[model samples]
Target: MSTTQNSGRWPHEAPPAGQDRWSWRPQLLSELPLIRRELRRSLVADTSDAAAEQEEELHERLVLLMDELLSNALRHGRAPVAGLVRRTASSWLLVVSDAAATVPPHPDPDRDPARGGLGLRMVADLTTAYGWCSDGGRKHVWAVLAPA
Candidate 1:
């Protein structure tokens, strides 16, 4: 709930106890393209020395993460009210809000892949850090990307 002011410390410091958190809400599947575009812009703006190639690579990774998050929301979040993706000065948070209260389970790396389910693990590997929380009647799954 506490406002994350410093860019470098986000995703590392837990939110302060009892503060209204800031969240972004996006609606409709069509809106995802726009969201992706905006995310790329934000990434570019936030990085001081990102090369064009590096930016392209980051953009691709962001798109993949976004796709995974969106797909997971649609498939598992159980009729999500809306999808929210938030960016702090230091981290990115992806939230898929559903009426369902259950949070996504963490991936078990040792489990046999034949059983399926690897999205969360991919997310963890791709991002700097990731976590989730459920409160105020919504569930949020999020990941943070380190500054380029």
Candidate 2:
């Protein structure tokens, strides 16, 4: 695969063609809370009260997106599941990586309401943008969301 242009200004050189700006492999589900806490610290913000509120809201959205993506990875992927999050000036880029190289599911409008696909559907609707790609045996499903 070739390098595609990223929509944000990240500090590192472009990822290895099909990878993200950063990555992590959570050892256990219990580590998610810690991950969230650390991610909260990585955020850039203003000092105003309004900015604080907006930052809070953005953090909440990031948490929700993280949950959905992680759950999907744990449920559908193979071992050594990983995750990634990048904080840009105007947005957050989040990704859940899995060992499975198979394609990630898209939002299916006609599927059962309570069965499957709702999570991906919610992800698609809630985020500014969403996409997935598999490089070799690693699959990365990612989303971009406004910071505020």
Candidate with maximal TM-score: 2
Candidate 2, clashing residue pairs? none
Quote the positional error of residue 73 for candidate 2 in Å. 0.4
- Candidates' C-alpha lDDT: 0.59, 0.66
TM-scores of all predicted structures: 0.62, 0.70
Off by over 4 Å in 1: 1-51
Candidate 2: tens digits of C-alpha lDDT, residues 1-148: 1122122211122222232444567756777777777666654332255577657877777777787788778777776788887756667788788888675544555678878667776776677666777787887777778753
Residue 109 CA error for candidate 1 (Å)? 2.5
Q: Pull out the clashing pairs in model 1.
A: 1-19
Residue-wise C-alpha lDDT for candidate 1, range 1-148, written one tens digit per residue = 2233112222332322221223334445666677667767765765577366666676678667876777667666666455555656655555556656555434666767788777766777778666666777766666665546
